[model samples]
Target: MALDFTTTQWITIGAGAIVSWLLLKWITSPSPKKFTVKVPEAADPKWTGKVLENPSIRDPSNPSTIVCYDPSTGYLIDTVPNPTVEEVKELYNRTAAAQVKWAKTTFEQRRTVLRSLLAFVLENQETICRVDCRDTGKTMIDASLGEIITTCAKLRWTIDNGESVLADDYRAPGLMMMYKHSKVVYQPLGVVSALVSWNYPFHNAIGPVISALMSGNGIIVKCSEYVAWSSKYYEQIIKTCLSVNGFDPDLVQFVPGFADVGEAVVQSGVNHVTFIGSPAVGKLVQRNASDYLVPCVLELGGKDCAILLKDSDLVQAIPVLMRGVFQNCGQNCIGIERIIVAAEIYEKVVEEMNTRIGKLRQGSILAEGEGVDCGAMTMGNQFEKLEALVQDAVSHGARLLRGGKRYHHPKHPSGQYFEPTLLADVTPEMDIANIEAFAPIMVIMKHQGPEDAVRIANLCPFGLGSSVFSADKKLAEKMCMQLKTGMANVNDFAVNYLCQGLPFGGVGISGYGRFSGKEGLRGLCVPKAFTTDRIPGVKTPIPPILDYPVQSAKKGWSFVSALNNLVYNPEVPAKVGACVDLAKANI
Candidate 1:
């Protein structure tokens, strides 16, 4: 029934098909431009230590609100509402209600919201970084690297591959069930919650939200009270994106308060919870989530280790070592806390670390300028603990090569600053070597060989991330395999986080379950197995031999055994025998 066409008509049809194909490609392709953030060279001096007369005041006039301030200089930021348990419950209710409608939306609609958010983040990169710096006291460069780049990468990844990850995954039916069709459908959980950390405020808050929305679940983020100032801005950005995209703004909520509020979030009848913070608090979250029988994905702290083999390239490894220890003032959960160096290159590594660490200026980067390499600590009280750890190590025969105490900033005397520290000859016995030091202190331990390096690296109770540096690729990979960490890099440090496709989480005290990659995106959903008939008018049926009123139990067993052998037996003679046995059993 084919119709013959003229040459001109055929050419016209081909031209139309080409145009449609081109249009579809253009529509589907992601934006080609790479998002960039401009790191400021200097900050205004006035902003450095501009504190209110009563900077520590917690807004006594208004009990409903909690005061927020810059931990670096005690500068007062705006106060935000502190939600009560009842308020937290209300938030969950609202989000859950919105999710009911949102779950019905098409993938195109979810992508539209993400595209809008991507545009907003790019246009307001400076504002976003500034808000994070103001609240967390991190440097502009740190904010650009940790906040801007990671958030953009997450948004882009989710937008590009989220639909495919959440698509119905078909499974092959075995020979015994050839007439059956099976698939796993990823359906959204009504509501999900994330109790994120305060280190990278922007990324921590936005990351779970991205997964929640992409998978069609509403999320309530319980942010760290330490970064409540910036959480408000992030909340606005997320809600505005949702509102503009015609989705209910209540679909995304941010709760900022004390521990009680966080407890409420976990016990608020949410379908799932994603918690990122210290190990101590993670236990509490697990306990509370247990009451409701709610499942949780906990991404807790890590005492990550970096091993430097004798054959490692010092030229390339030195910079990575410095950044791994000092980035975000070493507040990173997966930051390299201990450096295990081969005995051959132990002295060289220590000397290089000492020289570079001595030159690093510590101050309030937001108020100062490019002169400062390391910024202030968010938790000033941790200074006492850090000093105690360092003193303990030094007393145990560990040598303090450089700064190991708190740095008193001349310009901003009240600012919270820890000196960039270098501790050499650290042993596995010292507390500093085993404990998680979320500060700008580099601890180096000498290892006799590859086995010793791995032994020292795995000594810590926490096993989140690890790195092995060696010129010999095979040796490095072998060492990485032996390291007891969730994620290990052969020649780099913490670069696994940049590749959004890989699952990001850890084993042991680092907590359980993942919150990134396909595992994470689908973690927010319920994977339900679906089955139906592959052919029309064909279906599964109960055989009389296996029915409720079986006349003879031995005959029924023989019938089932013969059927199994006929379908699965490898030998042709065995299969033929089984078929004959099956015929006799049926008769």
Candidate 2:
């Protein structure tokens, strides 16, 4: 017998069923206790941490506390007192004093301090990894490779190579000015305000600090408020390294605060600034720096792309291509956001990528276990952004090849995890393709030819990085050259960025200035050209030959012409005669 029911009654039943399923899903998931850091009491005499806690260092009355969370489990981790404006100013004042002393130190002394830091990082690598993992929600492997290893490598590189790079360069005086000896001297540009981003906190902060200190400049690192735990840990270790090396720990100050403190730092008369964050905030930094005439090095956002040509080696490109998007859960500045492929090979590549992304293991955020290719998103707020982008793309006729929804596991109910996602039929007109989605999402766009692929890649405003993979090395190189980016790779992704000897920065809307190379070490310095009269047994005339009132010295032009002819004249007799004439005319 068929029974008739009202449409509203069926709708109510459907909604109730959906709620029941969600409840069941939540109940079946594993639960874990929230992680928390023990805040030292005011009267605790055993608090031996390096962070300042003076009597006057209390937070403002009714100040908003900066509560931190473990992104892996969406659990409360710890809370810290938000620094007041006055406190940030005090920190800067202290760093200024420290800079004066640090600048006076010898090159060997600075190198020693840097070497000590390298040693500390190596010895405590595992501990550092755990702290960073807890703070960032990235896998242990990422923390080890990206933070521990990279930070130590940068420190060692700076120590071993910094002196020679920053050495006083002597230039030969021109024949026209024979007595003048010129020298290019690189000097420290006082204190540097390093505004660090939350992602890859350890390496980014340590990288600039090593360069700044090795170049004999003081640095005040303002760590992200969201990840203050990692900053505290780094600060403690850095202070110990500094103290043991007979240097003032304040030379590298760590001030943990939010955007307000960062703003104060910029306007507080720092000699130079280096900021790493989104382009919007970077623009603010530039505007602030302009007020004080302070130059800045900004590593802003990136919508980096990769072009998979028809002749590309799919076997070789699969792993790197996957890692390029999934690594750090796609929170990296240089991570690939879009892929342009030749239409002939596009379908095959899309299927292969879909299968691989589908097979990727989503597990606990801890680095202890194996088989987890991805971890939770470091920032919980990013989940909403990722969802919005996916929705917008779907609405605009884009198709999700795989993994567009939030990921859930029975063992981690509250974890902020997004499955590795792949989207196809993406176009330049879609918002998802244009925006920098700092999540584990990869968009594939089809192109008719190599030129079309290049056109698609260059359509974005960001020019941070681009990569191309082709069986023909020369073809790949040629294509990569046409890609507008500060760093580009042929048949590989992020290889240039990983090479510490090369400059890692961006172009156009991605921001400017360089870091991680000789240019970076020198960017924190003030170059002064020193010229001196060094010619022996030469006495200057009372009136200089090139003086303004040199109408009486009309013969000087003849001497200049003779000197020019003496150097360039091919004939031996002419050269000899010209030299003789130059000396005679000058006399």
Q: Give each model a TM-score.
A: 0.92, 0.83
Deviation in Å, model 1, residue 158 alpha carbon = 1.0
Across residues 43-67, which tens digit of lDDT does each residue of candidate 2 receive? Answer: 1212112222111112356355665
- Candidate 1, residues 346-401, lDDT tens digits: the string is 99888888889989987766677678799888877687899999999999999998
Clashing pairs in 2: none
lDDT of each: 0.87, 0.79
Candidate 1 has which clashing residue pairs, if any? 48-367
**In lDDT terms, how accurate is model 2?**
0.79
Candidate 1 ranges with C-alpha deviation above 4 Å: 1-65
How many clashing residue pairs are found in candidate 1? 1
